[model samples]
Target: MVEALDLALGGVAVGILAWGFERYRTRFVKSDLIIAGALAVGLLIFVVLPGVYDSIGAALNIDGRFVLLSMLAQFVLLAIILHLLSMVRETNARFSDLVRNISADQAPQMDGGERTIFVVIPAYNEGKTITSVVKSLPDTIRGYTLQPVVVSDGSVDDTAENARYNGTVVVEHLVNQGQGGALKTGFQIALEQEADIVVTMDGDGQHPAEELERLVSPVIDDEADYVMGSRYKGENKTGNGVVRESGIRSFTWLINALTKSEITDCTNGFRAIRASGLEDMKLTEERFSAPELIIEARKNGLRIQEIPITIEERQAGETKKPQLMYAIGLTRAILATWIR
Candidate 1:
């Protein structure tokens, strides 16, 4: 009777081993099928073979000390095996949940009807190209709704006045605070108006307005929290001019190298970001160095992606590259962020 009971208990361990093998077979196969196979063999060696040996020992009246020790060994082995099986199952389940949540959270939510997108063009003396850039964007990206805003960076020229006339909501900075400040103003206004997505493009018209779809698709499809247009991603490449282009490439290379990240066209100002992603970005710089924005996004654990975009020559305006102190200030800020 005692022998029969021991065999029944042994069957329970075998049953648990079988259940674990079948349940986690796919995961085990990923690591090594041989390890999984070894588990099966070990189960037979420790549980099934032991039960047979114990039955013969009990029939021959084996010593009481040996019998007790054998029972204890069986219990300990069963417990350890079961614990290891549970751990693998739990770990895999946890990893799957994290991936699903991250993927789901990044997707852009669609509106029931026409969703409003506010395009913010931060302009600083971009009078010549402002009009063309304003007129170039179509009514929609494929079929999403859109609205454009021209945030004048205290342009001394007629950029602010012209943007208002070209069917845009023009906001003016009393004093030039730089591109980052202009973007902050535009984003705040968009958020106030309940915009679904807010796009920031260069007022200098270097961004091809016709290809706005590429900038907005990831947001519409829910792939990323922010999407920056990459002139290096595809055949579509545009820039302010040769000198400006070289500067852009050099700065981009510097950033990519420091971050150990791939940023094909880092300096392209053509980007579309979710209103949520801009919720708390301070954007303190009043100059042209906006790499701080990317740094901020990374620090906040935002999921950022890039889309290939066509870079175009400035349609009708002068370039606004910072010459001396502004460059120095930007370098200082970037280094500080790295050290921090």
Candidate 2:
């Protein structure tokens, strides 16, 4: 007869399998069905014929009891982990949407004349430079009207105030959401205004306003839907040190290998994207989202191109993240973006 523990675990397996089937009729995938089915079958077999693992264990030169326990622990742990991860991801998505909705309402009314190009600058705690960055943008990018929108990601400083004083559109986050979150807010606001193109520039004064036309030109000319400004292809006058430079190259190579595309700079914050094409990608990273954009842009069938751009050192404020944490966060973003 089967033990109590066997019946208890077997019932759970059966329930999960039933749920998987119900989901399959709707949104469940093949992988989910396979895993659920395997668990149910394995548990049922173990309950009905407990000695079945003995011969398998003998062939493997291990104790059957140990094999049974190991499988039991691993299966339960894996199931719980996967379920928790799904819940967390779903929660994060909902929260991000709500935040964007509340914050993006501050987007100034667009006059809806000529080709509207929104220059989105995501800043955090850069009060000393926010006004300067806003004032530095040209009145037009390749003859199209330019609107500057700044997203202050939970800055305790005067970032939002500075942008507002300069009469620039400011989306203020109530809490810190990292660079990725700020970009998402800015993108949503720009799209709501029926923008023709969205150009993202760093608010730290590192990205020159003169190069804005270079990034936006391809989209304006109908040459490419997505254009990434590559520092490697041009000049990195700031000199990001040897170690950081090596790390950037290493990560770029890995991302290129995974994506089957040669991207010179996967971490550049400067890019130009056609408004319609930008709406198709759903970015979820909270930090270091450059890699995510590259992966998603290629995946979404956008005409991706990289152009040479000059980058300078930050004029004010300190780097928000430490070197070690930056590397770890970037790796996490890459893996999450690539797999998800």
Candidate 3:
């Protein structure tokens, strides 16, 4: 017997079909028409075969068939959302690649040196400490000529100008793409200039310029392909208190477990990698890329080592990383890197 629901569904389906036909003929929107038709047909099917869903649900041992329909609808919506997100991510990647190329092209031509090392200091509005950081770097490390590439990642302050005035290589981004994006530009520059070792340090002055050699020593000496400067392994003068410290240790433990590598500090930005090692690694995270780099290096079979290094308090502006955002970003980086 035909029920009230069947009659209502039938009327709705017929109305949708007529409306879709009229809209398609007038507006000529294929997508709209297709969607309207599909939905109308689904409703019509439900109205014609009222007990079909229950029969199929019973066969499949589903407890609630109506709930199954709702879940399927939600799944479709999620799939569409995920597909859109993927497109946005791809677009971002393309834009970042363009910036990196432009930055590398505009970077000052390195002097005629047989071997070179690029110390990439990524800063955003770090004007106060930028100049001092550039001045403190050694002229050479283990005979490799030092090339300080200060990437002012869309800084609105005097960061780029200060570094440029101090006779350091400055790569300025027109838009902020986070530290990872700035470092990626530096890596591109390192590759183009044929650098032997690429050392990455923070521009906020947390990383000591004096310990640069110690950080790059393992990579320079061929002892390891990549090196990380660990505050836990050395002095943590952060003075930001225990919250940050505990978070780092916890994440480090989780990363070590996942990678099966005994890494003391996974969040440390002070790192050195062979130019060739960067070639094998694929890093994507714009903000939380620290773990992404380590994960990629490990995946590519690069021997990784962590050395003791001092991490001082920020010299100027407040920390960009808020606690909640930092935790979420770090977790995202870890899982995304490990799963891939």
Candidate 4:
């Protein structure tokens, strides 16, 4: 009866492994699947052929049950560690790519002398909305020539093509880095072009192009080194429900308390900064870049101001970020930036 129960449990474990393998095969790399398959096959052999398992245990002078349990624990632990290591490796590779891409070449210069307004739009798979967003941008903002730099963060769709079609200079990542990484790449290019003021807006149509002047006015007028757009203070329209709104308010309170600044909106991405002010700032948050930038800017004693602006609904496609996950990430980013 005991032997039968052990076999039954092993069978259930194998069944679960098989189900997982089938369900997530497409999501995993070929090498990872191969390793998982090999482990499953070995476990199956040890469970089905107890005599072979005993023979191996006897050779090692250990009980077969003990040997089996030890091997199982070791295999599970090794798989977890391997998975974590793979994540680290991938992250490191992406960081290396970001550095390489940023230093590769300077973007094409704008005509009519030195470009004064550099707009950096960071996009993931925003193919559908990118063209419209780029096209709607004014050729000039407040008498300064507008130069749009679109950083495609490893988009698998037609995002890069659409930006190019709209005549914006494009920089692309070979792998998907989060919004923050894309912005860093775009900012570097903007600075390289010797732009007086660098403005950042989402590639999604949520940020109105007509508001571009308002967003950058503080920087251009030399009133503030960094200008952050505030949805609460302006004509704002958000589709986010109660839970998200509450979370935003809580985060805003925490940021204000820590930074000793009264910011109405903490996560708005539509903002502008003087190119010179960014020289000493070190921004490292790839996912929570907006908050990180605010924290870093405040820390460096840069003049920060918030301007009222309108935020419209996204043009197309679902938001890539899950609400719960985004909240957690933003919280983590806020804490990380504060502690750092």
Candidate 5:
């Protein structure tokens, strides 16, 4: 009766495994399917040849099938561990490739004539909204020649093409190096072009192009070396959930307390800076660049100001950032920047 019950359970397990494979075949990659298939084959062998286990136990001088089963389990576990190690190695290889693509020769140059305003936009996989972001920029800001430079950070889509279509200069990375790396590249290009003022904004269409003048106003007047946009200070809209909203407020308070700066927004990416001031700023954080840049700027005693701005929902694809991970990274960046 015990043997019969074991066989029945094995049959049921095989049926369930087959059902799962059939139901989710499209969700798995070829390698995943191969692993599942190997497991299924092992299960089939165990179910169809129950007596074979006893034969193997006898050959190995074992008393019962339990020892054989344990050996098989160990083998399967080893296979899984080997697969995971391969995955990790592959991921490391891709990251190394990304780092290799970033050029070391970033020397600022001047165009034929002096240009006053340079807009640096760092984008990754923002094919849907990049065109509009580039097009919405004014031909000239407050009589200063406006030049939009789009840095495509290893985008697999048409982000570079769209920016170029809108008559903006576009630079592309072979692989993604995060937002900080992209912005650094953009800043170097802007400085090379001999821009007096450098403006950084999002490519996701959350930042309005109409506010360009206001964002750069303080820098133009020499009242501040850096102007940070503040959603909390002026008329603005926030589409973030309650948790995100709370996180932003908490981080802003912490940054303010540590930096001794009264800026209402610490993480807002919409901001402007004098090119000359940024010459001394050495940025290193790839993903958490916003906070690091702010902390570094504050430490260097560069004049900082805050102005009211608006942030809206992304116009295209879902946000690439995972909220919890982003907050954690930002927190670490803030602490690291403050200490260093």
Candidate 6:
């Protein structure tokens, strides 16, 4: 009987392994089939053989009826394992999607600048577009010094390798934390590296590296504590078609109206901040809405300025927006920031 219980527990462990396989093993890997075979073989050898005969059963102190009960136990264990696997896979997939979506966002650049600038790019699963973004940075800016950093947010792809090859300070997250989390990490590194000004950009290649100079100009000129890259002020020429342009126009108008701070594009991730102002704010967000950094700066009486910047369509892959969720989240963020 005890031998049958041991066999039952062994089968249960196999069922748990099957659950993990279903959750993380790639679809091409048929861990489920291997798990089933293992369970069957284990049960047959350890539990079934000993219970087949009274002579051997008594010698082993395992009853035939108890072995049957243990078989039922194995079935229950399998069912529980399957349920757990489904839940784990669903949760992990959702979290992975959130980080991937954030990583695919693009950044803007300054043409030429006279102030020291550090660009922090937060990336996740941006293997296809990072090379172009990194290579596109101008070798020199007239008025600003530049350091481009690519923060790989635990990408399953080769984002980090590409960034390193491009000669950027590549920071990697050990796990998929989120965009806001990645930005904080990048900023801290920039601080330690002693950057006077920091520019935050997305990794999906939506930003023009040349535009960074303009975004940082206000800070270098002492006109603003922070400078935001606004798509509205520049000539209406964008690689984005009419539909995307129209959407951006509507969002810009909404941001200007609600914030009363005259931000032409609050959702745009491309922006430059002075070291002092950025160091003062507590960057708590761990997702895409690091928008809180700007809001908090403004609340603390830090000057905010916007500069005209050109926008471009992604070099490859698709936009990560699932639907109207980004818009809805923006509205909530605006309200939250206003109250704060």
Winning candidate number (TM-score): 3
Clashing pairs in 2: none
Query: What are the per-residue Cα lDDT tens digits for candidate 1 across 62-154?
Result: 755347447656876796688679778677545533432332233234344568788988888988878877888787776667788887776
User: What are the TM-scores, per candidate, against the unseen true structure?
Assistant: 0.61, 0.80, 0.83, 0.72, 0.69, 0.61
lDDT by residue for model 4 (1-340), tens: 7578668757865875776587566676655566556666766666777677788777777775556657766977888798889889788867755553653264675554665888899899999999999999988877888888998888999998888855689878777778888888887877767888889999999899988888888887889999999989997676778987888889999999999989989989999998988877887777789889999999999999999999998999877888989999999999989998
Q: Listing every candidate in turn, what is its Cα RMSD in Å to the true structure after a full C-alpha superposition?
A: 17.9, 4.9, 4.2, 9.2, 11.5, 12.9
Give the per-residue lDDT of model 6 (tens digit) for 248-327.
56765665665556776666788888887877776545664545776777777889987888767677777766446765
RMSD of 6: 12.9
Least well predicted 10-residue stretch by lDDT in candidate 2: 64-73
* Model 3 lDDT per residue over 95-152, tens place: 9888777877888776665788889999999999998888889898888888889999
Looking at model 1, report the run of 10 residues with the lowest lDDT sum.
Answer: 99-108
Q: Tell me the deviation in Å of residue 92 in model 2.
A: 2.5
Candidate 6's clash total is 16
- What do the candidate models score in CA lDDT, each in turn? 0.69, 0.85, 0.86, 0.82, 0.81, 0.70
What TM-score, to 2 decimals, does candidate 1 have? 0.61
In candidate 4, which residue pairs get closer than 3 Å at backbone N, Cα or C atoms, i.e. clash? Answer: none
Overall local distance difference test of candidate 2: 0.85
Q: Write the per-residue lDDT of candidate 2 for residues 1-340, one digit (tens) a residue.
A: 3377787978887898897787777775776677678778877777777677776777677786547657766977788699879878889878877887788987767777678888889999999988888898888766788889999998899998888754578889888888899999988988888989999999899898988888898999999999999998989988688888898998999899988988888889999999999788979887788889888898899999999999988989777768898999899888878887
Better of 3 and 5 by TM-score: 3
lDDT of 5 by residue, 1-340 (tens): 7568567757865775675577568676666656666766666566677678788888988876756777887998998899999899688656644553453242224465755788889999999999999989998887788888888888999998888854577878777878888888878777667789999999999899999999998988889999999888865565778988788889989998998878777778999999998888877677788888888889888999999998877888887789989999999989988997
lDDT winner among the candidates? 3
Residue-level lDDT for 29 in candidate 5: 61
- Candidate 4 C-alpha error for residue 171, in Å: 1.7
What lDDT would candidate 1 get against the real structure? 0.69
Give me the overall lDDT of model 4.
Answer: 0.82
